[model samples]
Target: MFKKIAILHISLPIDQVYDYLEKRYNSTLYADASEQTKGYMPKIEIREATKNSFLSFYVKGHDPFTGLSVGSWKWSYTLTQEAGGMTKLKIAYEYGLFMSFISGGTVGHQAANEICETALALDALSNAQLAQ
Candidate 1:
């Protein structure tokens, strides 16, 4: 199992930030039937949500060669309002390998790093939107 956490502070309020994330993940703007029919449909399933405080989801993964289930990426977001009315977001990510042989042992760290990088990108995007 591999895990990583990232913290970000956004200028938006906690509730707004939480809502943005919820909608972003739940959006089906890119939905397609071909992906499902091909047997490699990547998706995020909401596991738990607590108003503006916490949100958890799972990103299903599959092996490219066999098209079999390899494992899933678990992601949790915690939001809080800071003194300056900024929203503090904490992103926790974990990847557990079901078939270790297929991906070797380096996938965990790479996945964790990607998760953190995603958090950074999200922060930048949010800030850019606020600027506009």
Candidate 2:
């Protein structure tokens, strides 16, 4: 098993950040049609509270780099409210490797980078929307 985690601070409120993630994950637009056709659509769940929230999803698919159906991937997000309406977000990603030849840590790192980049893009978009 391999894991990667990232902590981010977003200018948006906690609720807004949670809502954005919930909607984004629940929407089919966020997934690939080919993956869906392969019955690999991500299954998402959300738990929310007054100041904190958790979102998680799992998807089973082939590794893009090796074209191997090694195992499933789990991604989770934890959001907490902070001072001045800011949101602190934690993104966690885990990939379970079935093949001994594959380097789990390397794959986990690459996937984590991709996940972090996506989250940062989302943050930028959210901030831009607020600025308008």
Candidate 3:
């Protein structure tokens, strides 16, 4: 099993952050496509949502090294309002690999990759929000 957790503080209020993530989670990579067959499919499956607070989902996708779509990972995020009006976002992701042949690298490597990607995304979001 591989797992990773990340925390981010967004300057936006919890409600605003929640709304942004809600829309983002509902969005797909092929927004311009008119039909399902014509669109690029997204591997994310959102399982649950709690108004302005929490989200849980399953990501059916590939690890970078393996380059094969072979895992369904559980992911969750919790958002809380802080004293400074910032939103504290906690993210967790877990994947259990039953076969070693399918995993391209050590579990540590996979976890590190996941963490790096999550950090980069949060950084990008922070930068974008700051520019506004």
TM-score of each: 0.75, 0.69, 0.67
**How much is the lDDT of residue 32 in candidate 3?**
46
Best candidate according to lDDT = 1
Q: Candidate 2 lDDT, tens digit per residue, 87-132? A: 8898888776652235544676667676777687777867797899
lDDT, candidate 1, at 28? 53
**Candidate models: Cα lDDT each:** 0.74, 0.69, 0.68
Off by over 4 Å in 1: 28-40, 97-101
Give me candidate 1's TM-score against the actual structure. Answer: 0.75
How many clashes would you count in candidate 2? 0
Q: What is the lDDT of residue 77 in candidate 2?
A: 82
Return the clash pairs for model 2, or none.
none
Clashing residue pairs in candidate 1, if any?
Answer: none
Error of 1 at 118 (Å): 3.4
Cα RMSD to the true fold for all candidates: 3.5, 4.2, 5.1
TM-score of 2: 0.69
